[model samples]
Target: MLRRSRCRWVFVCILLTVLLRLAPLKSDSDPTTQLIGDVDNTQSFGVNPISLILVQKLGYQSACNSCSHRDLGFTGRVAGKWYSVWADTLWAAPGVTDPELDTPGFHGMVRSSVSLLTDDPLRVVDLNLNDDWPVPHQQPFIPFNEDWGESSRTAFGGASLCEVDAGSATAAVFILVNAFEPDLVGAGVAKVQVINGTPTVTQRFGPKGYWWDATTTPHYGDKISYRDERSDYIYIWGGPPNRYTGWLEGGYIYLVRVKAADVFDLCKYEYWWGHQQGWKPEVLTTFTTETAALWGTGQGQIVWNDYYDCYILVHLGIAGVTLYMRTAKSLEGPWTPDLEIYSTTPIDGGLVYAGVAHPYLDPSGKSLVVSFTNNNRIEVVKVWFK
Candidate 1:
């Protein structure tokens, strides 16, 4: 009888061990609980629970001429307040003739500006543009001039902002400029300083061609950078080649990184060379690409989520008609297959692009505040990750 009892006790211990191994890991601050109260067991995507909720639509009441229509840009925290820059256009209004369109000396006159978002009354303060700042009525932010040649007469917009410590008295604000020109589209880098609670440009660096632009590198500047506190490095993620010209067709994602302090130096950047070898110092080196296409058009945002402990990328996919989400454990990732989070075809008949994620706006960390341009209007939505 004693031998039988001992054997039963050992079996019970084994059963408990197996049960603990099978149980899903849970944390007190798990975002899954905050975003989705209860998840459906029968739902697809295995254990990945994701959902999008349209929290609220934000609009700006601007007095600038032809500035009523705007599209989402990057947002960053500055001086204890959240600031966002957006692409402002006047062509969206009826009877507005944009002379810059198709004019040889003139490229499309789409410019950008900054705004202060206040939560108390939920209003956007259109900060008065500095004399040097680019406005549709004035000059381009990163001006495309006679030096750039006739093919490159365009302004910068759809920019992403990141604050870097240049070891100066004030933190430097870096703006990744996306330039839209005829025939050739590319990205440039610009630096701005916050003077008296306003953002102003201090330096500008390229509508510089992509690393692989010689052979028609389709999409260039969908590159998004975030300072990874854990690694003390600035992680930059770029998009795959475009189907345009069929040079390097397919939606592929690429990644690169630089020290947070060396963000201003392009030479210091390192590319994710491959899985086996890992990050390569050469920026031009070809690397292991994302297995699946993240977006049809390469314009979106990739943000690090502290709560989820994963990187979330939001982009306009499905031939530029839908907003999709993909998550990964690392920036140079074996990213999960693209999941359709929202469709924009119904929202203004598919005149949308640049779906960017703003984590600062959402405190819960479970819901992401995303903004996209629909018919020249910047539309905001909240995506809840279950």
Candidate 2:
């Protein structure tokens, strides 16, 4: 039953990808699936009307000639300005799928798109546009944790895509990363390496490499509230995206568990409450710092304060909050706010969206405390560090 289920999901994905690349499906009766990103865009700016039809569609020419056609993004001009889709372009519902289907719609010149596929066990679409600017196509996207060997193909083989999750390595180790989707590489994937490992660099999960399969789903040791003084991994912790039901309807923080000694190629970021496919995973706590931070700082950031050596969550805006004090000795902490942190410029920052946190030892030695500023609002929470 397990094998049969896996095959069904896998085949469905293949069908979706095939139907997407093959333009103009035969009929609207079959109800083919579409794989478009949330945003659509044309390079030209200030145009009267943006055109999605002009975007180049690669008709799986490779599946017949060389290798199979995989990960694709669009780059074209409309008026004159320059804009681009992400490294992976979004798939639109086939014309037959829905001529009226306009979602994943165009967003003027900043046209972006997302490719939606269901995780066999229903995995989350871990996307990191936490920042406004999209990552460059030339930049290396290394995958920190994914199911490499579960598929019939050898490890790192039979890949449809790959990406590097470089969260912890960047803030933690300061390793300068540089990689690219190999040239002439079919079913393309890139080779990632740490410039320095005296201490492991930022650990991250990206959707650029390795196809997802069963068996490699469950992972142990993921941290829920990220706070580490000397840990070497940084993870994008959260359950699947657009969860329409259950506790995760509003989204929740996922525990990205990785050993200080684990390589970027082997780290794992799992749902904090564990996987509950087709059903919404429970959010251990209602404190969704970033997404729920509706104060309007965008996605937000999770940072480890090198100065304080504790976690600082700067989420909302430039002058929001800072980690000041924790009221209790436990995670059920009624943390006290340091109102002065509002408007304090972040010493160093990024989209601290639950990726990294600075951990501190509580006086009790029984609890762990970490602090961060959401935008400018300072927050300090006690968590279990050991």
Best by TM-score: 1
- TM-score for each model: 0.66, 0.27
lDDT at 226, model 2? 29
Candidate 1, residues 1-386, lDDT tens digits: the string is 99999999999999987754434435434322211112211111323335555544444233333333456666665445666666654322332333223223322334666666655222455564333213333223333345544233244543465656533323233333333433334443456667666666666554452233422332334445565646767665555432223323234445566776676666876766455556667653331222222324356777778777777777785337677777777666556667777665445464677777777766667877777766655666656666
Candidate 1: where is the Cα deviation over 4 Å? 1-47, 51-67, 91-110, 120-122, 128-140, 145-147, 150-152, 166-182, 206-220, 240-244, 247-250, 285-297, 346-350
| Model 2: worst 10 consecutive residues (lDDT sum) | 60-69
lDDT of 1: 0.52
For model 2, residues 185-288, the per-residue Cα lDDT tens digits are 11211332323321111332334332121112211111122223245433333222222123322232223333433324433322232222211233233222
Task: Show the colliding residue pairs in model 1.
Answer: 240-252
Q: Point out where model 2 deviates above 4 Å.
A: 1-191, 194-227, 232-235, 245-248, 264-271, 274-298, 306-309, 317-386
